[model samples]
Target: MSLFKKTLIKKNYKYKLLDDGISKEDISKAKNVLNSKQITMASQTRKFEETFAKKMGVKHALMVNSGSSANLLAIFAAGNPLRKNKLKKGDEVIIPVLCWSTSLWPLVQFGLKPVFIDIDPNTLNVNEDDLIKKINSRTKCIFLVNVHGNSCDLFKIRKIAKKKKIILIEDNCESLGSKLKNKHLGTFGDFGTFSFFYSHQITSGEGGMIVCNNDNDYEILFALRSHGWLGGTRFYPRRLKSYNYYAKKYPSLDPRYIFVNSGFNLRPTDIQAAIGLNQFKRLNKLILNRKQNRKLIIETLKKDRRWENQFQFIEPSKNINPSWMGLPIIIAKKYKKQKMKFLSYLDAKGIETRPIISGAFTNQPATKLYNLNPTKRKFNSAQSVQELGFLIGLHQNKISKDNLNLIKDSFLNIEKI
Candidate 1:
């Protein structure tokens, strides 16, 4: 390595949320796309979407600019005019209190009322029972976030959703390679979303995918992902019957420019797709490395004499073989007051940390600004999570002895702080 590169690595050796997110091979794939001069959402994106769909065990996959855009497309498609069963204004969508902002915002943006259900403190996912209880006649959808690679009985939830005829969308952004009962986490819902953000399971710098099984849903998503045109650019061929129908119906309109539905420009570039596909080819290895690193960190801390139950690690839920996004740690109640100080100490020590999914979405000021919770009902479990939980990076490679020691020493200092 060059001196500058070596120095840069040395400077970040203490701890980082990500370590060289893109591999040399990933960059090479992106470079090839750039050299081809066809870097738009074309063949590379389609190829990645196809491989992703087959690997995910889904019928279709659509690439977008980011996971947020994936969620937005899923929401808008679920409520699209062409959809047989659609959500409308004032319809209720069930979501976990401990969720990412984008997971909740799309519902609100679609004019759907969000019914926030508390998460299980252990799994950091929606409590299956609480979620079921919150479902009512108005509950048209359930937007579940498989938090930090852990999920709450998705089979049970899927059954309930099917029985109630409710749309189920899984925000599996943080758990792309994870599985429950040998099936991928994202495949159990009507729609599943995944992210390829810098710190996620795989990195393409910034990209995401939405997947579904229904043919009509795939068509809806295809049109909505672009500018609602029946035919995409010459590079993106449309074989769907709807394109033909629209083309024949509007004889005067150019077949290449037939507009059929409301949409957004959420397409991912070929460069991002090339990088994402390259990373995805090694997803299983990445997942395994992260799992091993997590195990090593937890074992190191617990075996340490200084370990006095100062922290709690989130274990994967039953039947889940997780691909963790990060190592989520919940401080003991005694150190709850010192959590902020401990985080600051870690930061100063060159150990990075973040809140667990921004801590209960309802606690955010934006929720208050939108008057989402008029009743002021509290979610105590979510509140406790907000107070106690934080996350550290789980690198794509095995933890080094020095890095392991750094984490162990810095984390155990919680007691002293």
Candidate 2:
């Protein structure tokens, strides 16, 4: 009776957003950490921080419990009193309306006003012209999200921010190995944050890292990441000028227990660090496989006779070598109304899917509750993406022809849904 029944029964097709991302070596690394009984934030975390920093070409990299926590730390550190160029209350931060929730919340929670900008629908990233137009004297920071492994012209953005003396923090959670003109995406900012959560470029069950090039900023980040306690860094002990001064100044107080600044408990467990470090070693391979799979899937769909321009695939920005997490597809205007039903059909056939980063975060109920968008005005580009966009995973392993065929068949049959 159902149109999908025959295809479903004949092929027995099923696809997932990820294919066992954690390898045996990853599990063994975590297991060894667990067996050591020193499962807290200890040696493994320190080693991972060192290796991550060197690989990213940053002076320091601190591990955190999650990417959300990394964002929280970065925002709070930028506004910290000890920092030379700190953001103050009422400062305006320009952000894309098409970003993750945590990316925007940290700005608001830190007492900064957010000015929303529309995205470039083609690249699915912020439009440089619109972003620059929004900057004014009140603007103190630029909180940019590299949306789905793609970036706006960050080279130009960095130039503008430097001229205006505005702080730049990059949320590189969705893009781990992505590079622009050979330089990593996250390394271009005052602070660059990464996530190693399951289904990302790497998996540690849950983990994240933050990188900075400046010694002073790195020290402040190190202190802020772990309850504001200063002078415990193994990465660069030579740079902590206040370590001896504070120790000798306060003879009565325990020098080890010095609290130089305000902070939160965002340290990751050693097990997570071990797992993340192991997976991180193979990052190049993972990026390559995902890139290949993405190319294969797009080629498969376009080469199919059923292809009638029913959907549009987002391409990387110029000079960007992308490390894709998933294949983002936009339904053509004619198939827009059928989006939900088509997704449901894909699900029934055992194909998993998700909306494009929760669909125009500005339109969410929480945004209304907080009165984030006081104008209640809709962002045209973000709204278009919300209505027409969805993503399917491009796994770390090679996709079989059957899997590719299943995706092509299900996607082309939007009319049936």
Candidate 3:
């Protein structure tokens, strides 16, 4: 190597967990949106929503401010008066222990009790067997989470949800662009949500989308996404004379200020929509790079001379073709107690990492307040993952050989560390 190149590499080598897929074009689009002065939720947002719905083969797509908001809107829409399979308060929803805080909290916020299920250590998702065991007379919903790029057996879960007449909402923030049996990950549920968070599959900086197959559900979601005003909904701009449809039939009151149902303003800005659309056009390419980087990292580690059976990588569950958001790996059981130190060591060596989706939601203090871990039956799989698991970033661009070797050398030192 040239002296100049060697110096540059020595001074500038750093590895982050992940980065957003942004380019000059995404920035240009955002600038155009700002210049148009329609920076609020308007045409751009609607265009992106339509494009997203078509890509996912869903009947309706509603753009939201964030993934958390998307989940919130979906849960609220499930209880809306206009929705056919509505959820009532105290209805039970099954959720996995290995979950993000917002995914499980949405159920509680919507007045549904969450029945905790354990994740399969091999898949890092809710186990199908455990999920079936948790179901009973009160299981009105299944709020499933598709972890990172991997997923649970969504088809079976969907069939079960259908046969039991239960609502299905997928927290698909991490698994966007993924598919099962030719169907997109989020499309199987009544509502599937996607996040455009900083390091997610694709990014608009911060935004989300909700997709559903029912027009009525879309109408309800549209109403709930705004201020309960059916402003842009089909039921809105009522031609009738009265606010209430039934009252309008009787010609009794003004229809201009009608309040159709409950709602919240979770709309995204046109700027975000413009950027998201730009990034989304290249989603297939981004998925490929992430997959390549993951394979490279594993191969590099295993090929190192100091390598031992120090870690285990989890694959996407059966039938899932994942568009992974990151590389999740678990340390061997014997090294479990040293996980905290090991992660710190990696971080100090310039490789950033994160927990495996806030590990065992039941272990969080928020769940503890409700005594959510009833029966006290130990979640062995969840605990095993918690003590052993962590994730690293997978970039949209191919990783450098030097970066790969650095990670290999650092990880190979796991035993000594």
Per residue, candidate 3 scores C-alpha lDDT tens digits across 1-417 of: 231233233423278766536888999999999998878888788888878989888988889999999999989988887777789999988888888988988788878888888888998888776787788999998888889877777778788889999898999999999998778998888999999998899988899999998877877877778777656433222222223554556454344445577888888888999999988889999999999999999998887777787988988778888899989999988888778878777766877778888988788888878777777657889888888899888999999988898889889888888
TM-score of 2: 0.94
TM-score of each: 0.96, 0.94, 0.91
72-102 per-residue lDDT for model 1 (tens digits): 9999999999998898988999988898999
- Against the true structure, candidate 3 reaches a TM-score of 0.91
Runs with alpha carbons beyond 4 Å of true place in candidate 1: 1-13
Residue-wise C-alpha lDDT for candidate 2, range 377-403, written one tens digit per residue: 788988999999999988988998889
Better structure of 1 and 3 per TM-score: 1
Cα lDDT of model 2 overall? 0.86
Q: Sort by TM-score, best first.
A: 1, 2, 3
- Who is ahead in TM-score, 2 or 3? 2
Residue pair clashes in candidate 3: 17-393
Write down the lDDT that model 3 would get.
Answer: 0.83
lDDT at residue 238 of model 3 (Cα atoms): 20
State residue 222's C-alpha deviation in candidate 1, in Å. Answer: 0.5
lDDT of 1 at 267: 88
lDDT of 2 at 391: 90
Off by over 4 Å in 2: 1-13, 231-241
lDDT (Cα atoms) of all candidates against the true structure: 0.89, 0.86, 0.83
